[model samples]
Target chain A: MALSIAGAGRNALTEKAAWFSESLARGLKVARAFDRDQPKMRISEVAAKTGMTRASARRYLLTLKSLGYVGSENEWFYPLPRILELGYAFVSSARLEEFVEPILQRLSEATDAAAHFAVFDNNETLCLGSVFSQKLFGFFISIGARQPAYAGSMGKVLLAGLSDTKLEEYLASVRRVAHTKETVTSAAILRREITEVREQGYALNRGEMTPGIVGVAVPVRNKDGTVASVVNANWISTSSIKAAEIKRCLGPLREAAKQIEMRLASGAVPTGWVSRER
Target chain B: MALSIAGAGRNALTEKAAWFSESLARGLKVARAFDRDQPKMRISEVAAKTGMTRASARRYLLTLKSLGYVGSENEWFYPLPRILELGYAFVSSARLEEFVEPILQRLSEATDAAAHFAVFDNNETLCLGSVFSQKLFGFFISIGARQPAYAGSMGKVLLAGLSDTKLEEYLASVRRVAHTKETVTSAAILRREITEVREQGYALNRGEMTPGIVGVAVPVRNKDGTVASVVNANWISTSSIKAAEIKRCLGPLREAAKQIEMRLASGAVPTGWVSRER
Candidate 1:
């Protein structure tokens, strides 16, 4: 499996604690087994995917259904809208949406592109908040959207924030896909690009994830100088003027990052656990 | 105490099954304990809030921390952004945001007010999607935002959809707080308003939730004629002309609801479990 359990490398005492509930972990894993690709699954498929017994999977699904997180019809089970509360619990508590959204709105409107703030999660770019350009007929990336860490600009910027050993482990484990002809699938090239992003303080993507889309991203650093999150903007790529467009967005994206950094430092946004320091 | 388990009234066999994981439920309940009001909590507070023994609460918290769903500093624990994946699993699987956001955008643009689509979630209005008014200075309601069912226009519209027994149970259990001077605290008054909403096929609120906001909502029905969701719009209340302003928005809000219903029936938006059938 390309996706490993998050935080599996935590210190030994925590993992071996008698208080740890394996059932809770397994249940959560079952709930997460559904995504864009497999929105609905039978108990057997879930068991196979999560490497759990069918009986165990059935119990988890039924429990989720009882909790209103999963809905079942016959043998197929899918997640329900009520499941959003789990994510909402975090977003609302952190109050990140209130603090970061207006900045994204302004950034999107000014750049004439979709603006997003994302964080690194299990070797993927997890979009925490997003704002669409006022211009009609644009792409959509909803909050909680995830993308491969090796391809898109936001993903690369987040990857650049990781420690060297963590970065190497990610590159070694991730199953890379060539989403477009321009996507860099080689680990060596990805390492080099990430190094450049680290030096330049920004990452740029031109038709890497999607054709004809220019993505620019910069890290939003914490007070302690660790990358807390990444702020990004996406433009519809024009073959003749891609560089100019990317250049135009960098100023706003960096400024937005600084604004977010200022907010994070102000103590109003409680991102207590978002610091990725190992 | 007002927030009961979402589907606690289900049939017997599912509850008695040996496969059900009580630890998972308790852990999820612990995670949910941290909200806007209590963003960070100590072990004793968690135990007190969730009605669990401190030892049990400690186990769940440690388990969650290990899974990366939670972070702790000293004795206080808060949810991490990674916790969002639990909710994103459902949102991405349903693809509701992609389908409904454009509709909300158009509604917000036309009405010059914040537009939202919501459903009844445990006696609260759960905003599934939202779009803010482009007029630059307006309210913000993020997706997963919840409001009391007895207060807001959307809440009334959703309450009107519930069965007689369900409605009675909800009224009996909910602890209503008057958010503003105009807020209705009397159960009899709320019942009258909800009955009127059912008859009129729409709901209107003037400074009920917030002092300066006027909210209008209409139900979106499924093919089976069950209320699947509610679409609503909010305008800044002009005291003397509130009635006329709400009247103007009714046409657009009802139209938006119809559009959502049409799209839902077209099979493009799969709302498998949203039918709210008893």
Candidate 2:
């Protein structure tokens, strides 16, 4: 998947301006190179993953260490606490959490499931808010976790609500890697599913992202009817009542979406604050 | 607070390596310049906060905008969704969430109050895990949030666990800004409270961080008897049973800490994994 991910826009960084610093971009990438799968990376691994030479990667990593962004044990590098300031500034700066959180509580309680609110960030789904489920065997994720758009229910819902041009850009940029047996890895199949979501006004996932976990979602529209976010309720499906769960969740899910829209329209959510979900 | 924050190591960046690129560090700083109170910044404000020259700040901010890290409304710069990736990487990479979360849930259930686990992140306390209270008016904070080492209860416990040398470094590095009227701004007073925490084996706060917010925290230790992290239970003290509440929560809180320590000592959490949570 060398060319597969890199060419497919595996996770886009904003296009550099004429004056944009490539070193800065690489530095941020070095910071991000440490995640759930590889919390610590050897300098060579960082060099390979970031596509930087060993010397370049070492310099960046060492600089990050001095800046308190990177911590090391032997040769492996991991992020430190000060790194949280970057993402915290992003979410709280939007102030979307305040209004979206109460709605998340209501939606989660009413449906008795974990709820998530996410917006489109470049080519991936950026989770802005999450309320944990009461179920012992539920899918739990943090607010800042990112997932691909074509595979996850929240991603599909947000993608379905995008404008024609934005949708085309997203489809063109996405990597159709199969995450599970149920994942739609073909761009044509995904496009069809997204179209159906646009028509049906909701999106549903049955083990597409994570096997045995089902998710149902809807788009939250801004006053201008543009998609501000996609909110979802997820559960672990050990039983056979998949249809029943979807049927039960859609009503509250849509209701919560409307409440969010009403609040957004009422000016509690600033107009033009959130860009297009993409 | 122009020179105040910059000189105080406001948002520390690693010092430049002999070959490290300062532009990368400045670029990351440009992304963080946007926050709740100043979500949108004019060009001058960016230069002022980052201490970059006007032309340099504009170039970095423009570069961040092109990269989708920042957004613009006319001339003001705001952070976009991409910034979430930074903090998210830090928390998930540690994987402490899985082990620490259940303890938080159990503790919250036992006390019917908010429960949190934090670790020493340099001079600040980084909240590793949190289970929100069912109370509508409880003190709610997301995981990965940071508080000063001298002010909050969790900060005090973590700081108290440090060695003499490390403690001296922290005391010297910390800026004792008074957030609340009751905040301990004097170095002598803070040192005394931290020493008391070491003696008593826990730390307590009454309207220190926030006027009506009271917090009680204890340190979580590893097998070798070094502190791994600090855990706290907090509530809104609208009622007068502050003394009784602390006493009631202490047993369950300490038990939760032991449970966490046992888990950490049991090899579920990798040794040499959390090197800096001293």
Name every residue pair that clashes in candidate 2: A14-B67, A24-B24, A66-B14, A67-B13, A67-B14
TM-scores of all candidate predictions against the true structure: 0.91, 0.87
Name the lDDT value of residue A23 in candidate 1: 87
Put down candidate 1 lDDT per residue, B1-278, tens digits, no spaces: 33344456444446565667898899999988889999999999999999999999999999899898899888889998889889888778778677788888888877888888988877688888887666644567788778887888888888899888888888889999999888898889889988999998888877788778877889999888888889988867557236676678878887888888888898764456463532
lDDT by residue (tens digit), candidate 1, A1-278:
32343345445446565788988999999999998788999999999999999999998998898898888878889988788888888889988668888899888877888889988887788888887666744566788788898888898998898889988988889999999888999999999999999999999887788887767899998887888899988867556236677789888988899999988898776556464542
Per-residue lDDT for A208-228 in model 2, tens only? 888877789999988667788
Task: Name the 10 consecutive residues with the lowest summed lDDT in model 2 chain A.
Answer: A9-18
* Cα misplacement distance, residue A4 of candidate 2 (Å): 23
Q: Rate the local accuracy (lDDT) of all candidates.
A: 0.83, 0.78
Top lDDT model: 1
- Give candidate 2 regions above 4 Å deviation: A1-18, A164-173, A186-189, A240-244, A262-278, B1-17, B164-178, B186-189, B240-243, B262-278
